[model samples]
Target: MYLLELYQNNYSKDLVLFETLEEGREFVAQIPGYTLETEDGFDVEYVNPKYLPDYMEIVFNGNIVPLSRFSFNSEENVDIIWKEISNLSVKNDKVIEGYSKIDAYVVNNDEVKAYVEAREANYRKAKDFIERCGYEADRSFFGSEDGEAILYRKCGAEDWHFLCHLDPLFVEIEDVEEYVKEALEEAF
Candidate 1:
């Protein structure tokens, strides 16, 4: 049994149980962008952050130039098209020369850069929390049945805290308190 914790955002958390680690990895791959936990030794298609605008071409005096070569400085000889209150035109040297705007077509598409960044940050926080708490999947027998458990404990603590049962069947015991005490005594 495997326990998978997914952090979709900073405020939301989802826990999933899988019989095998492979199943968990397969589920994580279905998500679009790369996550912090998914990057660790997982065989998934990691997506690189792609910038928007298929291509930015600026037309100046019948000459088209890429965005890289276009200058927005005040000293440049250019009249940037602006659609302000009515139509406005600003000439070089910070002067508003005319009251006419440029006719242009705009595409309102969603940007994924910020979303990807927030997702990755949330995943990183989840990973850090797991590490700080020393939580991990471990095989242990509850009562007489063998199963996997997600356990955690305070740093330098001798007792193991049971987080959740990864197995589908919820194995119960008469006294969970005695079990931890017995386990600790045996370890010492």
Candidate 2:
């Protein structure tokens, strides 16, 4: 029962209120609007400025859900990949370049199926496998910067949690193969 404010027309100050984050996201998807940030695909602001003092009222289109609701080991996967990359002694330039390629694919405008095919060919694994392995973690895409890097935590359990953005970059490639293998071994 989260509250979300959606701005339909920025210039006109027209807005719509939603009881759930999903409803706000759906409305935004159906209608085009400008956002104030870039992390969650879009940024939705609050119509009233006083409700949340000292915080800008905005939503990250990518992270509106409570992480406790989902079960995925996203952080572990990222750490595993990071350790693998580190163990391989991968050059910083190579890491940056590799991540850039993944970012490009993520930001691409092509159809989802085409992207999946291309990604799979590049990674040598099916898209479903990647997702199943906790790489492509589930997210709400609420539309805020502070809410961008939310990690999922189990409901009523503070210790068990994982980050959502662990896919694509976690898989090792080329020079980082040995590290990837080690990480995969530990992952299993």
Candidate 3:
């Protein structure tokens, strides 16, 4: 995928995101005067801080001069055109920016029951609380049939999970008594 960035006489901006260079070249050929360029992929953030690309244009005489580029018929007109191009924009793949594992945490069905039974409401708060207590509570994907997914990473093991699934919301824990125990010994 490529970003077909439009420019008119080195002034103005517009973006026509395309899935391939051929698509971009087609758009350029149709609008004679408008110069097209490529930009690196953008992040998934929809509200991009970058300036909007150059506006649309039409080729004037054989050698076009002076920047009298075209404008959208109306805001609706712009919206309609953007509606077509926006989806074509290359969005960054979902990424796990960072990762942390709860190797030293504990989980008991009774203790984390506060989360499991009424799982919906308390999940967020409980998850946040667990993270603040210095452990990533996870249960589901990495879980086993005999047990819920409580991620207890072995000391110095290379099997750390992606930060996305390493959070407390997806897992359960119990033992309300010793929440975030200090100086708990770890077994590799």
Best model number under TM-score: 2
Tell me each candidate's RMSD, in Å, in order: 24.0, 20.7, 16.6
The sequence of per-residue lDDT tens digits that candidate 3 reaches over residues 64-154 is: 3222223322111111122123232446454322222232234443344443444433345444555655556555554432333334333
Q: What's model 1's TM-score?
A: 0.19
lDDT of each prediction vs. the true structure?
0.37, 0.33, 0.37
Flag regions of model 3 displaced more than 4 Å.
1-126, 141-143, 152-188
Judge candidate 1 at residue 138 and give its lDDT.
38
Error of 2 at 123 (Å): 4.3
lDDT by residue for model 2 over 1-188, one digit each (tens)?
23333222222222434545555555444321222334478443322222222322234455443212012222221000010012235434432211222332343323444545544443443223334444442333333332222233323444523333324443223333353345444544
Local accuracy of candidate 1 as per-residue lDDT tens digits, 94-175: 3232232111112111323333344334434433554544543233444334334445555566777664443222222334
Question: What's model 3's lDDT at 115?
Answer: 38
**Root mean square deviation (Cα) for candidate 2:** 20.7
